[model samples]
Target: MAEKAESLDLIWEVTEIARLIGRTERQTFHMLQSGQLPAKKVGGRWVAERGTLIRFFMETAA
Candidate 1:
């Protein structure tokens, strides 16, 4: 039997969030550190819930 790949319910790294927001990884990290973006540390990695990112865009777009 073959193992199935895990399905991710959220983004758990700055690089992934950067790609989603069209920003550089370094920029994402800066935002995270400055509290300009929403994220939480899980298992030693920073993660952002998908809904949170979408809400951020909606709020900022308004």
Candidate 2:
């Protein structure tokens, strides 16, 4: 489905997620390990949804 394909693009690697959130890799990893970030460990790598991260920051920024 088109939605499925589009969803694929929403998945971001840890590095990209860190840059988007303006945090260093170490900080991002720490947050991920502590369950502070809206991400999950997939296949031994941290993966996060782009929109979810954006929305999380937007909501929390208020």
Candidate 3:
């Protein structure tokens, strides 16, 4: 059977964002709640846009 590929345009869930940033899901949630991170509610779930996250990291690093 062939493996399924992930969609690049799909929004990332909190756990995935946590893994990407090396943080816990709770920490990611806190950041979202505190407005330190940008996210949107879609279908009752919080999701972060990949481009927004990349820009946020770039701005913070500078």
Candidate 4:
């Protein structure tokens, strides 16, 4: 289905981002709190769009 394909494309929740960056959920939350990671609060959950996350990585890498 279209929705399923979209979901598979690219999306990162705090847990996923933590796993990708080899950190704990608590650490990831700290990054969010410190304004190091690009995320948006949606329905009481933090989420990073794929593009924003990639951009954040690139910028921070520099």
Clashes of 2: 0
Cα lDDT of model 1 by residue, 1-62, tens digit = 22322443588799998988789999999998898888887787889877788789789999
Candidate 2, residues 1-62: lDDT per residue as tens digits?
A: 98886766455567887898999988988999999998988888888888788889999999
Q: Please give me the total number of clashing residue pairs in predicted model 4.
A: 0
Q: Which stretch of 10 consecutive residues in model 4 shows the poorest summed lDDT? A: 4-13
Ranking by lDDT: 2, 1, 4, 3
Window of ten residues with lowest summed lDDT in model 1: 1-10
Ranking by TM-score: 2, 1, 3, 4
Q: Pick the candidate with the highest TM-score.
A: 2
lDDT of 3 by residue, 1-62 (tens): 22323433445688887776678999988997788887776777778767678788889999
RMSD in Å for model 1: 5.2
C-alpha root-mean-square deviation, each candidate: 5.2, 1.9, 5.7, 3.7
Tens-digit lDDT string for candidate 4 (1-62) = 98866774354578987876677999998998798887766777777776667777888789
How many residue pairs collide in each prediction?
0, 0, 0, 0
Error of 1 at 49 (Å): 0.5
Give the distance in Å from residue 14's predicted Cα in candidate 1 to where it truly belongs.
Answer: 0.8
Higher-TM-score candidate among 2 and 4?
A: 2
In model 2, pairs of residues that clash are none
Single out the weakest 10-residue window by summed lDDT for candidate 2: 5-14
